[model samples]
Target: MATRVLLLMALTLYIFPIATATFHVKGSVYCDTCRAGFETNATFYIRGARVGIQCKERKTMKVAFYSEGVTDSTGTYHIEVENDHRDNICECLLVKSPIKWCSTPDSGRDKSSIVLTHYQNGIVNHLHYANAMGYLRDEPLPECHKLLKYYLADSDV
Candidate 1:
């Protein structure tokens, strides 16, 4: 009887894992023409930009799992990870851009860390928001100076 009870418990644990959570990482990409840190009126939401979510091994820092996607019409990309990433660290990173003029990833906003397999109050469950990443346009538009004034708090009106 004792042997049968132990076997049943082992099988039950194997069949049904303790953790049950899937993650949804959602974010957008943009083009920064003026070389300014943040978005301006001249900023453009880049459609079809390549974005990826990568989870690295905690001990070695080597990539363990990854997935990529192209931005939709609204410049948004959503990646769904099927397993719990509790033992690893993951981030949403800029991969590439389809537009010729805007192909350079902005160093400041290239990656955003995401926490999966958790629940927070007032926050959606199993959902992570990556900061909007941007690529630099080859050349800044002539009107960029005027449009950039909107983002400056000290600018003279």
Candidate 2:
């Protein structure tokens, strides 16, 4: 009985680390052509936009891990992060925009917080999805007022 228990323990030790060794963080970046705070019908995905994942120590506020990725043709970015960052605060940040006219980062939408620890999240696939980040256009599109009217109709304002 003792031998069987020991064997099971050995197997768990080997498999647990391998299962939680790495994680994948996925998200997309967009261009707010309408200059709206959020996505709209006229909004479009930004290809070649730069995005980054940064993990910082919660107590010391020091950077622990950092990596960058470029958006694909679909404006989606997938970053693979090594190890479990349970003790760090991780975020997906907007780095750059391919469109010069929409290069400014959107306020309150530039960075998204993401949890990277597999054990804490209770997720078996080890995939973490962050909120979409965006950049604002220097000038609103010609039909922005019309598009924004649709949104305002739902609000009291």
Q: Quick one: best lDDT, which candidate?
A: 2
List the candidates' TM-scores in order. 0.80, 0.87
Q: Model 2, range 1-157, lDDT digits (tens) per residue?
A: 9999999998775555453468889999999999888999999999999999999999998999999999999989999999888889999999999899999999999999998875545565667899999999999999999989988999998
Q: What is the C-alpha lDDT profile of model 1 across 1-157, one tens digit per residue?
A: 9999999999775555446667788999999989787788778899999999999989999998899988999999999987877678899999999999999888989888887654322333667788899999988999887777656658666
Q: Residue pairs in steric clash, candidate 1?
A: none
Distance from true location, Cα of 7 in model 2, Å: 11
**Poorest 10 consecutive residues of model 1 by lDDT?**
116-125
Angstrom error of the Cα, residue 133, model 2: value is 0.4
Per-residue lDDT value at 13 in model 1? 52
